[model samples]
Structures are given as C-alpha cells and as structure tokens.
Target: MTKPTTTPAEPPYLRIVAAIRRRIADGELLAGDRVPSTRQIAREWGVALATATKALTTLRLEGLVETRPRTGTVVAGTAPPTASPALPSTPSASPVSSASSTGTAPEQELTLERIVRTGMDIADAEGLSALSMRGVAARLGVAAMSLYRYVPGKDDLVLLMADTAYGEESYPADVPEGWRPRVELGARTLWTLYRRHPWLAQLGPISRPLPLPNLMVHGEWVLSALEGHGLDPTRLFDVHVLIYSHSHGLAVHLEREAQAEAATGQSDDEWMDSRAPTLQWLAESGRFPAFTRIVGSLGDGYDLRLDALFEFGLAALLDGLTPIIEGREATSR
Candidate 1:
C-alpha cells in the first residue's frame, strides 16, 4: 500500500515568525523583552539575512514587537488585541488626546549631540544595520527630516558615532617602560573598547579606515611604542598596522557570537552541541587524519576560548617580532 503524501513545508520566514509568536504566547518572551536580532535570527535558523528580516517585519506588522532606539527590537508592551464581532458601535463623545491627534510631539528640544548619542546607542545595542535617521526620529518623537538639520546624513552621523565611541578611554599619561609592554598596553586598550562596543568591529575594512580624530589618537599610542626601535619609517608604520589588524581580526567575531547567541537563544556550548551531528560525520569520514586524531583525543570536548586564543596569538606574534625589535639579524645569531 502507498503512503499519503504530506504538504510541503511553510516558507522559512513564516516558520520563524510563527516560532517567535508561539514563544511570546507561551510567556517565554515577556513584553518589553528584546527579541532575537535579525543577524541572530539568520544565524540561528540557518536562513538568509533577508529571510530573518522578513520574519521580523512580519512580527512588527502584527504588532508583536517594536524597535526601541537604545534597546533594539523588543516585544511590544501589549500585543495587538484580537478583533471581536462587529456590533452597532457608537462613536465616543470625548476627543482623543492632542498628542495622539497630531501623531507627534508639540515641541522637540533637538541637538546634534543628542542625535549622535541616540545613533550610537542604537548601533551599540542592535548593530550598524539597524541604524537610520527615521528610526532616530521615531525614538525622539519628531519627524525624520528634523534630524537632517542637525546631522548632514547617515554617513556623517556614523563618523561622529565612531569618534565618540573610540574616545571613551584614554591612554596612560606616561608610557610603559619597555617598547613591548607599551605595545601590549595599546593593543589591550583597543580590545577592551571593542569588548564594550562589539559593533565597532563591523566598520570599514583595513584598507579604508575611518578618518575620525579619536581613532588617530589610538594610532598615536601604538606608533609611539614602536618609534625609537631603530626601524625605518615604512617598517614602523607597517608593524603598527599589523598589530592593529591582529586585534581587529579576532574582534570581529565578538559581534558575530553575540548575534548567534541571540538568534539561537543558546550559549556557545549549547550551540556547538546542536552541531554535533556534523562533527560526528567529519570525525567518521577519516579523510582528515590529523583532524580525526585531534577529535579522538578529546574525550570530553574542545572548548573554543577566544580570549585564550587572543593571548596565545598575541604572545606568538610579539615573539616573532622580538628579533626585528632587538636589532639582531637571524643569520648572525
């Protein structure tokens, strides 16, 4: 006997939306709680960014969630109430609130600094993609065009935000004793800033760095460390750039990990466990003998510790630079 055929699955976005809706209805997600970010949704569901965005848009349309300026997208204070059967409804005698009638605030005490700070807060919480003039206006209870008067455009506003974020911390008044220690301090300082604002890592690529003044301030710290080491101008600048790249290279993953955790609603280890099937397949494949041996030896499991990795790589990199820094030729040694 032949079995009956089942219907094809719903589209991915619809599935995601339904899942989030169920979570809300089940009390797993309370009002005003942050929902999974778009990047998070994409990473968690193994769907395209657009699909995750569409799911979020659908939830917004349904009034299940809202975008708050400094807080990203969160569950709406109240779900859109269900519609009841229409009776002979009568109009209300009282008038609606004046603020509600106009759909805007009567007066806005707007400022450039306020706008930039709002943009930074949004970027810090939700990431760069969630930022826009319109969103800022919505948060400020003003028209979107009003922001244009204070800030030229999104690009200009982003530059200001970057500078402000980078300027949060300052280097020491007196530099460290040794060149190596000074460089280490500078690198760690930048890493700490990135830890505070992970979204900073998703900025421009290495070749196209931002011309923000505060960024140059951090550069000065690194440059001063390598200055009196007898290296040529090109070599000094190159070494500084390489050191900056090392911090940034590892830093980018901080934001990605945050997105993943939010989307999947799981810790790093839990997420790794979800992918155990693939790991098992790779181990059994035996094609990669080295990889198989490494996994085989791990009776418990290997923990991917980024902080430890960073320290390890930093030491290795500085060790390799020791020869050049000490003005010693490898052939002579």
Candidate 2:
C-alpha cells in the first residue's frame, strides 16, 4: 500500500490569506484593487487584528499586496511564488543583500543615524502606524533584530525621528521686530513642519508631552517672543502654550484625514460627496436654520482651506492677546 498522505490544517491567519488570495486569483480583486483593511479582515473573519495584520504581512511578503500612502494595501500586478523567502528572525552582524541570494556584505556605515533616517522615510511616506522594526529592516536590507541594537523599540525610534524632523528648520538669527510677527513666524514654522510630517501631529497629547529636545527648541522660540511684553511668568507660559495649541489643534486633523482616506479608500472630496444625501436631509429638516442659511449663502468658490483657517485663527488669537499684552505694558509704565 502507498504511504498515507496527510494534509496539514491551515492556521486561521493563513485561512484569511487564502480567502484573499482566492479573490485575487479568481479576478474578483483586480490589480490595484485595495485589499480589505486589517479591521475589515478581523471583523469579517472573527479574528484578532494581529492575525489580520499577519495575513496581510504574509501577503505583502508574497507580493500579493503592497501598501501605498493614503491608499492602504492594494493588490499587486504580479504575485510572488508560494515559497517566497521570509525575513530572518535573528540579527545578522553583516547586511544581507536581497537582490542576489548568494552575496552578503558588511554594513560598515550602518549607524544610529542611518536607522533613524530609514525610520523617518517610512513614517513620512506611510503613516507612523505603518512603521515597524521589521518594515524598517526590510527597507534597509537588514535583519529585524539588528534594529534593536541601535534603537530599543518603536517608541524610542519615533522620538528620534521626531527630533530629526524638528531639527530640519530653525529660527533665523535675525529676528523680526515685533512680538506678534515673531510669534506668527514661529507658529507658521511649526505648522509647516506638521504639514510636511502629518504623523508628527499624532505623536503626543497636550497634557503629557514627549520631552524631545528639538521640539523644545520650538517652544523656546514662542516663549522668547512673549517675554518682553511684561506678562507675568505664568501668563507668559500660558500664552506660549496657547500659541502652540492654536497650531497643533488644527494639525492633528491632518493625520486623521490621511488615516480616514486610507481606511475608506476615498479622498476627502469623495467622502464629502458620499455624505451629500445625509447633509441634504439635515438641510431639509430645517432645525439648523442658521447653519443652513450660511451654508446656502456660501459661494461656489468656497473651499475648506486649512492654511487660510490657520491664518484666520492665528490672527484672532493674536488680536485677543494684543490688548492683554499692551494693557500690561501700559499698567507697568
């Protein structure tokens, strides 16, 4: 008799992967079609997000799916063979070249700076949530464990990345004459940084802040602008905090919008269009008369310009502060 043949049971994650693979193979999911997100997979399959993540990771390794910033994971045109090589679980002293299976070369210049830079690039292109030690290692063609040698964990790496990003621009040595202008410049600088790195806005809460040195440099700039106005120490710090909050409050939306776009696979305008029926219902309800009237009066040229909003809010905030600062100056005089 022939030897008994036994088929191994598929793991839950592999089962999820197989379902997705079947969709792709059957032409149900075409190339460039977005794969179901981890949340979708977890909900549909009654599995944990980690399992969903692993399934996606396996699919990514097999080149079935690839992540695009603000687009989530999409099916690739060509899928890798079933036996695609996996990333090494152990750290390697020398770098491994993926381009050629046989060649291994020393990473002579692999410093902490290099690791931080790679992390920054990933965080910049994909949101911070997409970043992982293994992801960074793959980008650098290094073992995942090798990253731990330079940075202890993801938290530390993010802090380093934030510091490096903040250090990109600095206040000019020649300061603008007025406090208002100086504060405006400072706010705009911080805003520009947030615009460039949307993920940076999601890093910390206002109550508890990361004690990153370069970010502190920005605080110092804003604080220095308020110093000569004769405000009390507490008042001075409060003003600084307010100015920081003005910029930061608006900036937090940037990453959230990016995440929403990726998760929904819809751009902001597309999302708004989808909600038109609900908005129309609200308008027809007539309860929100003031809101409806203003929205109706708003011209076709009306655009939700964040930069304009920032400037308007900044000006209003500074206008409120101006009287306080000038009143203090007069009171002291």
Candidate 3:
C-alpha cells in the first residue's frame, strides 16, 4: 500500500495568516512589501473581514508588516529588530568612499538589483525619508557620487524603487475562470503587492497605464476582469480607477501613522492620548451633540481599519455596479 500523505489542519484565519507568512519566509515576499488590504485578504481566503483583520493584526504584531507615513503597511524586512544593536557603538568620521574598499568603481559593479536592494535596506531600517543618493551610497560603503551614475537622481531612484518593489507580486495571466474571480484576484494581487510597499500608493496614478512593463500583466488582469460587465470602455476605466483609488486612499493613512511612529517612537494610541485633553474638553462642552456622539467612537484605541473600510466601500461600489456588470455579461452571452 502507498503511504498516505496527510495535510495539516488549522483554523481558517491561521491558514490565511500562514499563506502570507510562508511568502515572507520564502523571500518571494520581500521586506517593505505591503500586507494585503483586509478586503484583499477576505477575498483571497474566503474569510470574513474580522478574520482577515485578525490575520493582518497578527502580522503587525510579529513585526512582519510595518505601517509608514504616506505609505501603507510595508514588509519589515528581516533586519535586526533592535537597530541600535547593529549600529556603530562609537562614532568615527571617515571620508565616505565613492568606490568599494578594493578600489573598484562602484558604478561599474552596480546592477539594477544591487542598487535597488541596497536602497531597500535603507528604507526598511530607517524609511523613505532617510533614503537619498548619498544615504544609500553610505550604506553600501560606496561613494555617494557613484550611486548617481546608476540612479540619475533621487527622483528617478525613488520611482525605480517603487517600480522595483511593485515587481515582487505575481499575477495570473489567463484571467481566472470567472469574471468575479478574475477581478477579485487582480485586485487582491495589486493590493497584496501594495501592502508590501505602501509607498507605491503614494507614487500616484500611472498616466500611460503601461509605463511599467512588469506591472502590465497586473493591469491587463484588471481590465480583463471587467470584460463581461455591461460597462462601456469608459465605465470599465472608471471602475478600475475607482478600485485603485480606494486601495491607495486607505494606504495613505497607514503610511502616515507609520511615519508618525518612526518620528516620535510612539504608538498611534500614545499620540492620541496627548490629544485627549482637547477631545475631552470639546466633548464635555457639548457645543455639538452630533460631534460628541461620533467623536466618542473615534478614540485613541480606535484604529483606522483600512481593510474594513476597503471591504465596506468595495462591496458598495461593486453592488452599485451590478446592473452594469450583469448587463455586460448578458450582452456578451
């Protein structure tokens, strides 16, 4: 008799979490990679928003995904948990080298991946704020001027960084078996990648929609998802744009909170605590009864549940477009 191979059993949420965790451990999901939006997770895992949130929360607690200001939850790249442990204990100033210690021209040895990977390390440990031509050069122990040879300038470098990070995700090309499945998969793929490098959200809309060749497959996947929907080309464009906006809009908050924490070494809750006096004053004054009622719900303990908000809004948008989607399906058939 052949030996039986048994699959491991775990809860739905853990299974979902493990899927993400496995990617991270496998290096397929790199550092500074954005965690999937709760909506994306829910759709991918066929779980409820609450369960999805629990999965992301677990990742955040594990130091896997870090939220940054103007960015979203990004991969925490497995750098030393305590950076101080690795930083030079005593400072000594040496003229920063533009070339490696072996005296080889840094630019000559530079590959796109090398430049990007070094830059990512800086971003992961510090942040985008600390990333610049000179900063990345210093990290790589090369001359700041040498980085310019490859990067052209900081703006180009940042763009390349965003583009490179966006490449980490894999999108299925044949389009899923069903329109709904295809669309859900496309959105989840983009959202998962965005969750890794939330900074991509801040990079804004791509005017050409094909500037990043690597991301073209992703765009095609989204466009294909709308194929059977009764939407005209214009409406199809609008639908994809709407979904894209929703993901980035929520990501902006995640990025902001992450940046704030980095700057102050304080949690969002702590920052909110300092503002309590003002909030309390206003609440007690009762100048606006409606404001008081709503403000109470928005507390320091309150989180900007991006996933929940995304799901709620996405559902509403998709629901509202049902006639358009169904009409397209009917006409096609």
TM-score of each: 0.68, 0.69, 0.62
Candidate 2 lDDT over residue span 117-201, tens digit each:
6676667667789899888777776777887888999999999988877776689999999888999999999999888877888
Worst 10 residues of 2 by lDDT: 88-97
In terms of lDDT, model 2 sits at 0.77
Q: Which candidate comes out best when scored by lDDT?
A: 2
Instruction: Kindly report which residue stretches of model 2 are placed more than 4 angstroms away from their true locations once superposed.
Output: 1-106, 328-333
Clashing pairs in 1: none
Residues 51-166, candidate 1: write the lDDT tens digits. Answer: 77778878988989876532457788953333111211112201212222234543366667666666765666676778898987775677889989888999999888788778
* Model 1, position 148: C-alpha lDDT score: 90
Report the lDDT tens digits of candidate 3 across residue range 16-69: 878899988998778765567666677788876667766766777787776554
Of 1 and 3, the candidate ahead on lDDT is 1
**Where does model 3 exceed 4 Å of error?**
1-108, 205-210, 294-301, 328-333
Off by over 4 Å in 1: 1-108, 260-270, 330-333
Worst 10 residues of 3 by lDDT: 85-94
